[model samples]
Target chain A: MKSNNSFRYFLIFAGAGIYQWAFWHETPGLNISIFTAFIVPTLLFLYPESVKKVPFWLVLTGLLSASLAIVVHASLFATIMYVISIILFVGFAHWSQTKSPVFAIPSSIANLVLTPYTFFAFKNYVATNNKKSSVFLKWVKLFVLPVVILIVFFTIFYNASDKFAEYSDKVLFPIQDFIYNLFGNITFASIFFFVHGILLITWILIRNKNTNLSDAEKNQTVNITRNKVRRKRHFQFLGLKREYLSAFILLVLINLLVLAANIVDIVFIWFGFEFKEGMNLKQFVHEGTYLLILSILLSMGILLYIFRKNQNFYSKGKILKVLSFAWIFQNLILAISVGVRNYHYMEYYGLAYKRVGVCIFLILVFFGLITFFIKIMQKKSSYFLLKFNSWAMYLLLIISSLFSWDTIITKYNIKHCKELDYEFLVHMSTKALPFVDINKLSTDLSYKNPWIINSNYNYDYFYVFSMRNYYVKQVFNFLYDWETDKFLSWSYYDKLAYQNFMSNPELVKSYKIYKDYRIKKNQIENGNKNSVQNRTPALHSDESR
Target chain B: METKIQFKTELLHYILMNPVRSEQSGRVVFSEQFAIILKIITS
Candidate 1:
């Protein structure tokens, strides 16, 4: 038992050490950080002894998926994937120890929220009773006192004699410099992060061990009791056949109204009807998409409420069910109509992140409506629907995260579109900057609108100066501004993009020439204007002559 | 009852629902108290 405890402590220490190294180095990016974080806890606490088979495989797959996401530029998609992986990691970790997937969500949340308290409690308990810890404390005290005394005596001796002081300074200068360099780089934030990592690992191990032991003890004791009879209250609303009939009628009415709207969309949008005087693509697309989403959600809520529990056993339930299904089907058509509108808008104004988000949201709503239909047809419980939809969302988010959307958007606009939004492209993040053909843009704009070149020059100067200042000065001016902290905060992708921009010597030279030309022109114009403003009558007459 | 009233009451009931734990002793300590205890121990 003592050895096992010692091993656990060693693993915790090792994990903290790795965390400190990664926090400073910032080489491998987010993947290494997340992998180490998840793996450390799993290995120390919920490993082979406690982890179940299914959850183990699920967590492993999630880790790999997150790793793949990191490789793909850490865009929004990758962020979503990372978030899902964390959820799955937490869920599976809980399931492994308890052999029950029911409390997975709450248990995971508790584990995260209660980590500090768990660490404190465990440390307090161990310090009170553990002989090894007591001995370690004693040794530390012994060692620290002697070191203090020696340092004091040496200081006194050095102060007493100039010769002794010089000799000691010569001997210790290099060592002093080394120690200063080492301690100078360590900051409060790094120490806090190191302590957090150790606490998290310790919390997971102790919490899981205690939970497993308690569960085992619970299994050993079996209590047998006779079931008690309960009184049945009169449910006055249950026998309301008229209410069901009226609800069915209302559902049909709502469905017909939705169907009429869908028909209009099919005719006007799908068949390419010309817009009215003030009707623009933006208005048409933005207005209907959100309404469609809200309507679908509202329809699902109504269906769930009407068919909940034993209400499904109503005599007129079949009629209501048919009407509900028809309404859901109409909602699906509405989702498709919204998608068509979004596509048209994208065609006119070009694709953007929000438009793409609308498409993904529509797809999810379509799946949700389909699941609602299934829930109704199979008479499944609400829990069944909840679990099914949760898993579906998880899968959708994972798949979505795999795509590098910025690269996709940049490539598509550049290759397929006739005219590119150059300003938009320039404003895009470092990931998308490489795909933009700035040379072609520069030539085209220089011929058409030469003034744009001046503006572009200004934009580039401001962008570079601000980015450099942000990464170098403002970021490093914090309280815990260690080398590792600075490195971790710096965006390597941006650095690479800046390097790529500077690689084009011709572009840089052209920008410099254009700046000089603008400066000279401005100076000449200012000189002439000033002369005109301050001119005397004789000077004005001479100028005229 | 009208449908609106019934819906409102149901929503209220759900909002008011609380978990019932059988073993009060097993409840996790609040973080503030835990921190205070830690401070005492270290001091």
Candidate 2:
């Protein structure tokens, strides 16, 4: 028993040390930090005797996803991957410790949402443990009193003696400088990671220590309570015949509405029929996509309410099932229409982060509709449907995080779209630099508004354009700076792109020429104030100059 | 023993429902000081 406690303490200490070392340094990349995060918790909290038992594959996959995130330069993709990794890390830890049913979304959410309270609880528990923690508490108390006295005495003595203060300054200033150098570079982000990592690891280690019942036993107890409730409350609020009739009427009305919307979408959007007057693509897409998702959710709620346990035991339940299936099918069609509307919008205006999100959301809704169908067919509870949908969403998010959408969006716009929005591309993060076709950009300047490109351009736009150029130049300069260490930036993908840009002299020359033209044009325009009213062709000729 | 158990349960309920008063002024209560109250109660 003593040896077991000693091992647990050792694991906690080791985990905390590793967390500080991995995350406290400057340029701590996503991969090593995520990997250590998972491994440390598993080492500290998961043992055979522990109630929660985490499978090894979940941890491995989390580490792999983190590595994938590190390799990609796109901030969105890396952020998603990092988020997924953290979720899996905490989820698996909670699952292992509680011996709860697998893929318990609520447990994972509770672990993350209640982290502060969990840390507090663990701290309280540790403080109460006399055998392992009392000695440390005693030492801390002993050390604190003397340090307080020493600081008070040192302040009084330093104020009293000028000569003593001058001599002490020589020693104290260097020590202060050393301490400043050591701790000054510690950023808020690094401190957050350090504190959060320790709290999470400690919380996981001690969370399961008090649990006496396995999940199966807990479920049995809940079932018994539910049975008691079931006997006391008669769920037959309405007669079977009336319930069936109401559900039938509701499903019929909803299905008709869904069908009408789908037909309109099929004609106007899917078949490329001309839209009604004043109905632009933006208005059509934005207005319908989100409302359609809500309708589908409401449809799910209706089905759940109508087909609840006692209500489904009617002789005409088969008719309700059929009607509900038809309603789900109609909702699926509505979801597809939403997807088409999004696609139309993307085609008109180029791809963006939100459009990609809508597409993913549409896919999830499609799966949810299917899950609703299965729930009806299998006579499964709403809880089962919710759990299934949550897992599906989790898996989809993880899969989506592996791809760099910025590159995909850039390449698609360049290769497939008719009009390229250069301003938008320029404002994008450094991740899209590798995919930007400079040659294509030079030729595609025709689509830009003439007034915006002329000598009297808006100051705000000019400022943004110049800032974009400045950022590109800074990236180029950073690549060849040679004085700073290479590993300081933390992004391997950004370095690789900059290195590639530097290696190709022709591309480098093209970029420099383009940048110089824009700068010179701006300077020439700013030099001539009267040139603004004339809309001079001379400023346009500056492109050639 | 039963009376002691009931007293403890009632005390827990009272502590949970009522706010903690500061030492300097009993009239000044803090609703967010549950952790401190919990520490005191457990000790």
Candidate 3:
């Protein structure tokens, strides 16, 4: 056991070394995949029992998510999925019982919540065992922890503030020099990571048996308890009969109200709706989506409240159950209506981030409604609903990361909508640069700007028009980065961007010439009013390229 | 047997003529994409 402790300490130290190597001064890309892959074996060596027992499905999930990072450089979704899966993969394997392998719910939560508090596990071990501390040990304890913490703070402060960095460096130059000599070669970024990694590994490896969550989770039954005999008349308030009556009445009223709303939608929005000139499709989709989401969430809360404990097992629960199912069914239709409205809006106005976000949100809501349906039927606790829904949510995030959404939005909008929403385009991800066919700037079906007629404008349309050179500059910069970025930062999206760019280099260049002429024409038209705008900022495309 | 392919010019005509005025200040200018859209409903 003592020898194993020594080995464990060595392993944690080494894990930190590997962590620093994998992540040093780099955004997530191939490095994330490499580090996660390394983690599996290192964890196995440190925790044989846990690592070996990680279920095949969870391990598969870890691999799949890690592959997304390697493939697309870990978008926010992919990085989250990869991180959570590995944590749960190890946590659930180590802490969960054989019967409750799905103890992933509690264990994953415990790993996050419990680990931070255990960062001093090694120090505690050293303290508890060393009753008569050696003089050297006393010296180490008094100085080592504070000095290590000081260095970490110093590194972070130095990086965060240049003013502080200049002064701190001069004062601490000799100490830093000594560290550099001792370490052979190192960077502040590396030092920061190495210190942090030690803490992270300690957090992961040290088990707090007293505070373990899975034990309690394992004992929780999904099904609520039912008493065969009724409680005494004095305790009738806690009885099912009263609760059942109240819930039944509430559900009936809500069901009727919701059905009326659904019917209106079914007849108009679903069956036959036309986009009229003055009608606000933007408001119809955007405002309606946010409002509907709140109501749908509230409906779930109401259902959960109504069917609590004994009310679920009510002998007369038949009507209430039917009503609950009916409400869920209606909300499902409501979700669909929101989706339809979004589709119509997108079909007319073209895709934007908010529109894409609504679609993702609707998918989650569908899962929620379905799970709520299951919960009532099975007489299950809220935990069951949360557990299954969380798993679905995790899987959905991974699935979403599979597509490059900004590029998709860019392509769809340009092709499908006549007047491109330059607001959407201007802020699109670098990958979307290649998809923005500059030739399509001429494809404005009306030839004249529509906003010209409305005249209730913010920035002048022609100003936006002449800013094509700016857009061209952005594309050239994007392509240049694609060419120059190291393989460590490369993604499948970058490869596609490169190919698309190479396919249309000449067409993209034409936008610059066209815009330059437009800008010159605009400046002459403005005559002395826009002299500042006339001074065309030297846009050298070749320099950008 | 002979097969003929025909294109409907109505969608193109709509695009050439009518452009929908945008609603909100921040949103995209509405365009002929409405007539251009081929919507198919599924249960």
Candidate 4:
């Protein structure tokens, strides 16, 4: 608080607090406030010695001010283009900073804020710039990687296509679909990803802080007169503990689980497969439940063996005993909760090829094996090549046997149900679209329908009779007035009311001619002088026109 | 008077999305009534 830089720090913190407060109110404005957070804090945190940095704040203020001014502006796209200039100019300036890449923080900020705009910008940049266009070709291999994997998977599962159909047709498959819809949803994935990133960043920051603190201590020993705040700050930062180590290890496992999920997604694509509704959650729970149970049982056995070895009763200490039992208890609870949620009813259970779930399970197993390695290393106090070899052998045997049997079973099932069921395909298409309420559909349609024209040919009409509409209404009954507003459109009525007619050049020209004629006729009826002003119209409208 | 009228119009636009109990009544203003509270703070 006494330092000259302290005021700048206070201002940065205050501004950030205000930004977050303001950010909570505006749905999309959160991104802008977040951008400001990165910009202002990063400036003060990096360089506290500058007046020119004030102009950056001014630019940010102007952009927001202009946003308010242009809220009612007809052309939102043009307004967006103008806002892009503010973001880009500031971003470019930040990136040009030569020292520590504090500016990289704002780059991330820009990425989040202008994700939609910047994606198109990057695409355009590549399209227009000759030098950058070729850069895309270099990393095209990443996209090809999934294709190659899919090809390999298809080749391996060549005989199981029929089985896939049979498995999908089962009544219990919808339950599986529901599980997937609930648990393996993109929302959960996004939340998990965000949490994982934060944890990773926290770990890195902690490590850096430790290094800086140790360096500061070393410097203190070298310099004699720097008692600055000696005795008071001695215990402010504690050395790393076994607890933090465990947390870090848990973080790594979480990351591995996420990676496994992504790999499972790839396997699904490779097999030309989809998770059954309600089954994703079940599958997710099932995979995790089994691994955790196995890990707990295995850990319990190890703990019991340790207790026997140190049989002095006193050596079997309270803390160690509690930790071992707690770990087992936690794993058991995890298994039960997941199992109940996913596979509680025997009638609901069925066998299906969930390669994604399998893949994610494989990842967890991999982490367990790594944990095993760490344990052996800790106990032996040495690196053991034999331990690694034995572990690999065990994993290979388990994986190959499991996969081979599953494949065989799947093949047999598919072969029995060889003929393609048109009904099943129709059911799937219906499920994908869901039930559609005209009112809800129109609201969704509003953002996309720029013409602002709701006529006799309501957007709801298309959705009401549609298979898509039925599917939508079955799923989302949250919208009010979802049951009503059922209507249909004839082709001619649809063309005039909807924006479809405007899309065709010939129709547009014809409409213009008809509109002018109607206007003049109306004006003449009203005996208005403006009727003459409308007379420079087409003398003869062509058939196409 | 001029500044107040302009401010009132701007504020009206800002708060238009929010519904009030009545055009003329005692205002039991909720903290989250208008997004402008956040807008001004964030700015």
* Maximum-TM-score candidate: 3
Residues A169-191 of candidate 3: C-alpha lDDT, one tens digit per residue? 78889997877644644557558
- The C-alpha TM-scores of every prediction are 0.64, 0.64, 0.66, 0.23
Q: Estimate the Cα RMSD of every predicted model relative to the unseen true structure.
A: 20.7, 20.4, 15.1, 29.0
Q: What value does DockQ give for candidate 1?
A: 0.01
- Candidate 4 C-alpha lDDT tens digits along B1-43: 0111122222222233222222235342444344434543343
Report the poorest 10 consecutive residues by lDDT, candidate 3 chain A: A536-545
Q: For candidate 4, give the docking quality class from DockQ.
A: incorrect
Query: How do the residues A1-545 of candidate 1 rate in per-residue lDDT, one tens digit apiece?
Result: 22334445666687666566555434334535454465645553535543446654655565566566664454545655665565456545544554223334556556666667656565543323355555655677889989999999999999999999999999999899978654555668667878887875565454432232224323422122222455477764544476677677789889889989989999988886665666676767787787878888888888888776555666558878888888988888888888888887777567777788888888788778887888778777665666556666666766776676776777887877776766555445455666765334322211222222244422322232211222111111111121213343333443455456457654344333323332333333344232212211110000000
The CA lDDT of each predicted structure is: 0.55, 0.56, 0.62, 0.34
* Chain A TM per candidate, in order of listing: 0.68, 0.68, 0.71, 0.23
Q: Among all windows of ten consecutive residues in candidate 1 chain A, which has the lowest summed lDDT?
A: A536-545
- Cα displacement (angstroms), candidate 3, residue A379, comes to 2.4
| TM-score: model 2, chain A | 0.68
TM-score of candidate 4 to 2 decimals: 0.23
| CA shift of A367, model 4, Å | 2.6
Best by DockQ: 3
